[model samples]
Target: MSFTVNARKITLSLLIGSSSLMLFACGSSGSDSSAPAPVAPPAPPPATPPSSGASDTNELIKVNQLGFYPASQKIAIVPDNGATEFSVLNSDGVSVLDGELSQANTWDMDGRSVRMADFSALSTSGTYTIEVDGVSASNPFSISSDVYSDAHDTVLKAYYFNRASTALDAQYAGDWQRPTAHPDTQVLVHASAASEQRPEGFVLSSPKGWYDAGDYNKYIVNSGISTYTLLAAYENYSDFYQTRSLNIPESDNALPDIIDEILWNLTWMQTMQDPNDGGVYHKLTTLNFEGAVMPHEATAQRYVVQKSTSAALNFAAVSAQASRIFSSIDSLSALSSELQSAALSAWQWAQQNPDVPYIQPSDVFTGRYDDTNFNDEFSWAAVELFLLTEDTQFLDQYLSLNVPATTPSWPQVGTLGMLSLLNNGKELLSEAQYANVQDKVLGFANQILAEQGNAYQVGMTRSDLIWGSNSNGLNKAIVLLHAAQHTSGDAKPYVDAAVNFVDYVLGRNPTDYSYVTGLGSKPPLDIHHRQSYADNVAAPVPGFVAGGAQPGQQDNCSYPSSQPARSYLDDWCSYSTNEITINWNAPMVYMLAAMESAN
Candidate 1:
């Protein structure tokens, strides 16, 4: 989905199950930190090995291209046109397993009729295609333990590729390496963010956050959710990330690689605050969207503009979470304390300036993450502060609001606060308070899990297919997964639902393209990312999740179909459906790590 990155406001918006990231195609697809860069990052192994024995490979028969975990649910969607028995064919065209198909059913999201080929009974590890008697043969997919390892790593490495202010050394960046860009040491304080201490045009050195999306700009509202999601991932599954290296420059550091990556952005986030007032800038960007060019080639005046209640609260929430998370590490203890202080300062500024919202200036034109309601932001930030300081006043503020728990997005984050409470509040809250938080969280998770009733068997409804539908899907997985971990009951249903959503993202959805670039079959090659477009490299960076299908073609791009599920355009014009973002990739990273540890 390629459109101008500034159009990001238009949206309000997988898995192979091997040992980890079964929704992703897992394997040793690249050299590790100790190895030399390849002439090109190895093309992810084709999801399907060639079927030499002669049978058309049909694109309509969508399965998880990375395949399924041996024990996970394995249902392939086939066209509803009278297909009864389906055959699972090995690469040699030999039938390895056979199953009866479910009756054709219409999916309201797309009005496309499809049937399910149940093959969960087949546990053999091999690359195979599903052949329906009348419809067609599907893409090749492998079933094996740890089938998604390589894919998991590749997606996480995408962040490393998107890092700003640093030259991507060939040893780690491979052929994708580029010169340093947006050092951010010479940033201007826009008139909107000017204060008594710093006027308009004040030079500030704010550097090192990941580019917010396909755009080169960075937004605090977006980064807050993105950073918090990664921290939650690391907190929930520290064991999974401790040794999983993307081979970035810091892979050998004492801290976990994920922490190193988060720190890069966290440091930048800390700079967005005005040291004088504790108010935070909404975003750092040029006057207009830059052309598709390498980061080093873009030359424009960058400014931090507009202080808002939303931005300040987001800053407070993320910084508080970071402070608590890093306080345990001796090397980061002081940084933790500094972050804690900043969080409190930001919280105070928001209390004093509770209604300040971002207003794009007359001269400046960029992506505006404008929002009106600050309830979710306040609750989230307050809960985080409560957790960080062990101060009941912060907890009291959060609980007094009695905010309804909902799924998370940059614009809606109360659920994240609730998630944290469910995750860490039992020890701190009264039994009634803990149970109330638990009910809200588990209830939302149940709501998402119920979406598995759809014909596709993924926990996504038509409403879920928004601007960044892919992230919506994965965020649902995050909720179901948290439920699975929080409950003492059978975790299989929750895990299965989460796995099914991963499968949908990988290749099981209406569009056979795996939403992730470079990892699964027929991925979106020309994703709406500036770096990938301008890098001169033929392949887009691997592992960045493309914004999936949605009916609102806000980018003015042509579509294969108007159906919400098939409204995806893989070209650069389809920014509404094809752009990649830190927020989108964060859930993917979280879900992948969670899946790896699910077993």
Candidate 2:
């Protein structure tokens, strides 16, 4: 089960199925470049006939409000009963395509059966709107070959925008510029974090990382998965990422932009582990969530609080993965060794303190990523360490653990171990072992695809629409992509399923808004992010993906309905439904990049 330095380089031949779907030529030509060009303003549609019976007040199309891929299925929702036929008009008021809507499933939120419009045949590169007979035209959308390239760039750049201890200038940050804040060199070690080497008052220099979400706290569990996703992106698609730049402070570095951005948080994550025993702090946070103030304006004292089995195991997994990845990179070889050492030591610490979990004190009110389950974390660490060091003991531990095949999440990380085994553990694992891992991955993907009949036509089931529902969808997409890479069967269904999840986030869902900021025609303007609220800019930072529609109104904001997909608000007060998180955006970046690269 273990691997050695002499093991074969991980080579993946992703056999994506391109046969089920036909990629149509873009309707409007001359926009073949990777970056989108400006288009003529959309012309108004002709007046509708009264006999068409379409609701003139309601917008008919539901898409990723930003736009669609030239060859991808572009779905639209007709909320009211009326004409089943629709028209696609180009910017110059030319009717480019006309089609009849197939009656899709009914949604519980409004008791309206949505009619599906297939505009995938019109693969034209132009600004256009959808018209449903007598209904009002949809918001303008563009069809382009490179529709998601800029979106991929912006989502990755969001991590840099959320970087603490760094000034965001006009050059990269544009109008959302801010002074440097949270220089955490003097961060106090809380009572729970007191150890033989570092007492309660001990100070540590943990200066940089993206804030956990809308709040300016850092959670090791969350960051571990987020960083791993970014690293996985680089490992899987290095060719696409090697020269890709978002004009960050480290854009000129020899490392790929993705690696450079991940390093910013990796450096901070390194500081979370105690050099004395390799126990990682659960979180570095203020006593309570800070007020809605700019980073420079919020002056609360921060503390590195508690050490838990979850934190140690998470650190072990990420560090081990990092060690394996950076071992080959010339500039990061030394850091790789350090990370490997730290990862092994953290795994050792967790062995002695397996039952320890994060317990928030009575006064601390910040976000808690507390988890009682350590089995998944332990399995993940063992698999990662085994992959890097090829140590039989870690491999033995991994085999003994009952790792789950679920998608990667902060709490459930057994899937991370499963992915590594299926992706890179091929040389080390036995034929039966590889088959077992592959079967598990396929099982998860099949489960997701099985739920495709939900009202939204996205792969997510009703239960998946919880807090950070968009992340749930994106994580599921990640699972499907992995399955597509490994499956011997037709991969188109899995790939299309993954794309559906991304489309849901972009604007294809019932909410009619892109969960990500600044991409869609209608995006969350008042997301519960502090910088977005404090900055004088008209739009929120462009790429931060909001935690999507949650039926549970966990915060104060009033929601229109309790239906799974209808319970979202763009209000700043709706933290449960609208907060932006680094973990949420990481998988989004991965999904977008995967689709872009595949194309």
Candidate 3:
């Protein structure tokens, strides 16, 4: 089966504001000042109108919203009339750094020529803001070594905030607490899923997985890539994640906080596979999407939909990766063996039914992560199986497919297979094979570097800004980081490029709004998340990264411009622009962990 990437557009008939409008009424009584002889308090100094400098106007400063001090930092300023002079002011309102903006021939997507000032020379740690003479001062930012540490934990904990099946108590969830929802212990098998072994109406206990996105659904294909990224983070940076705690219920558990969090999803994923055969359900979803309500309020029965080759292969690949990672833990050896057995079984099942693809029934209305292309999935699974078991047949199958290197998306993950093989399976490959894989990796990295140089210092190209474009940037960064581990000649450029991509998502973009919720100076507030919408909290749940700017206004919300970076709305109504998903956040965790580890 082959699947094409399609953007899911949802039309909302009524736009319900996520925020409440509060009106304050002030009544002054004439007798209130009866003690006038005491001299009316000095008229409060004339109220200073709030400065609109940070407003989306002619003058703007784009930097990482969380700020930077330990590394070289560049501030992008768009002056009203090509003004050259700019000043950086400390929190004390005293000038700290002064420089002239270097005019650039390049123009932003919105037709504004972007000028740059390098304040990397000023390494002193302090809270600061940028002043462009006529424009209002830029938003205050901090310059310290640990500036992003809190944000790193916040983003990682976002997964906990989105956990299903378990209630998020105030103890861990803080302000985002909510009752448990989607206790999928008695999921029904869909009619289309009826097989010779397990017929329709069979009840399965498929409980516990992160909601796919803002919608309360779980998908295997998306979960595969998401779980793989998280595991890769643990694989590469065990030391960094082992001691870091996200304050989850499992913080006191014997396993690292990261491992505990991964297990929350892995346990649910394990249930998605059919024990009778190695087949896996594509997704578990309700008949239709729930409205803007809390998890407990959106009570809908879920059904495990039809099995697909993609799902089976995805399951196999992720299980194999998990098997390798968990084998080292003394308590998890048995579980590791189980995953390895499941992976091999799933691979065999997929081999027999290679053409099985996901087809959403007419009765089902949800985001269909449908992919007709199973070749990449096959390659990925085969590579993992080969690496885990040292099986020559699996390696031969992977080589026979001759999968090319490409950027990884949920639907297209052949490149991830190549990355895993190059990063971990080199000992099993012949010299020629190793060279071939190495060349491909370098080729892909070179392309990304060229794109970065041409596109506003960001690693993604204009075409990359599709739905969930932020993930595209982060996913590309993941590939680059992996490549940097192998490349010998000055890996700093690759690491810096990867860091720049993360910086863009954090707050260093034209929009000046951090795509992640509840972290930056102007983090997104109205994320299109149901729990956040129904929780009655003043802020959305922290750490979930939004699907960045895309020209396709699928939600029909008004955007400032169609330009990639400018086409975003921080409103719950803008589902296409603001919805968060596990796949998007997974790479974020990888990127942040990688950066922190490097530091």
Candidate 4:
């Protein structure tokens, strides 16, 4: 999350997907056959030794909102002009504050300017400045605190609730906002109270990215992808943890309150089910409660089972976990069985429709299906379902399926797919089947390594390497390293590649913990570059554009017409709150578990 760039510690940012980077321009290596070999350039000058003049030189500094807004609020002493060092220091004295900006390099320095270092901490409220040598900037320049905001605080608390317990809403959050398109939409569903209270596994919700109504009989429901995920998490928290029996702490009530939200989600998900098929529905449109909501084959969207059912199954797991503590089982069994059945049906459908491209009227997957998560969904669903049902046949079919060796240019999501293969494939499939799956999965990893070229160090630009492009390549590398943890066969090279990718990304944007860097519909080439999430906008730099030059630019988010992502550069090293809570934590835990299990 944090990096040491130029002799100072700075935070980094999070990335959405991996980048296929072409970092250094392909120019003459200066090894001409006709000319003599060129000598290596002299190393840059070393940093000016800490001013030897005095232990505390009396130098006063003032804030000037010269180039940017918010003024020089939290500027700290950096190594100035050297690579390979970083740290966050205090004003008047070089006291280091254990802050995220000290770790992430990207936010620490905004294109030759260190503006992100100017913010109030969440725990303590004050304005302090950073000092270099004996000179001190205005003390009003620095601020430190533990709490970011009320809303962020609530979100973080709910996230940890899922992490500590059985991933109550985590699965839904993971599958709903899936990084890429893969089959598994048909079976994914939201959690029901039964599942949340005494979960056996996950539930069946409609495809992510849509809203969920409280109706279970309706085949299709209208929903917003992100909101449904948030609502589900909150509802699950309240269902089991909010009760007086749990004795949640006053200050830590955020977790229990979130459980209440999950319970609401269960009731809401049930209400959205189609009475006829017993399938979950997306909730994004207005409906007349009095009339018949028939299944409109062409209008109704279907996606892979995992996208549709993981939320529901996750609820089951939550229920199962909570029941262990609260002693509630008979109350939750029937609904749990129903959710389990729905998820099973969706999985069967996926097995039957391997070649189906998008989430079509006949298919379960909704929205765009051409993404990295597609294969991942299949592997995850198959493994989970196989475990729940003990259906070796399912494992056979999953192993037999010929997943394409191809992976999208996007690295973050693609890397996840690789992890899924590594985790689920080995967990469920037989030795032979696992080997086969590994063969196919390795092809995808190799594909990225091939494109990386010299950028192998940084790997590829997550979304795109050019200007304003957001890249998840570092994340992809993380997943790859995880996958490589088990099994053997040239995995070391892949692991090395992943490490290099992380190093390069962290080196360039040291302050950002998340390593993400793009906004709008696609990745940005630089800080100033801009792009829209909807229409195809002009790329500021020639030959620099992301998502290709295709017509009808897709929103950065999979959902249509979603708001463009904003670039908050300073994210490197605060904590793994958001990233770990959602994308990073589960997968990291799952991967580490697999590694430990293997050992």
Each candidate's root-mean-square deviation in Å?
10.2, 10.0, 13.8, 17.2
Q: Please provide the root mean square deviation of candidate 4 (C-alpha atoms, Å).
A: 17.2
**Model 3 ranges with Cα > 4 A deviation:** 1-59, 73-80
Clashing pairs in 3: 1-372, 1-373, 2-372, 2-373, 3-372, 3-373
Choose the strongest candidate by lDDT.
1
The window of 10 residues in a row where model 2 has the poorest summed lDDT is 19-28
Model 2 TM: 0.90
Model 3: lDDT equals 0.75
TM-score of decoy 3: 0.88
Q: What order do candidates take by lDDT, descending?
A: 1, 2, 3, 4
Misplaced by over 4 Å in model 2 are 1-56, 108-111
TM-score of every model?
0.90, 0.90, 0.88, 0.39
Candidate 2 deviation (Cα RMSD)? 10.0
Clash count for candidate 1 is 25
Instruction: Give lDDT per model, in order.
Output: 0.79, 0.78, 0.75, 0.30
lDDT of 2: 0.78
Error of 4 at 396 (Å): 2.6
Residues 421-464 of candidate 3: C-alpha lDDT, one tens digit per residue: 87677689998887777777778887898887632577676556
Model 1: per-residue Cα lDDT at residue 457 = 86
lDDT of 3 at 477: 90
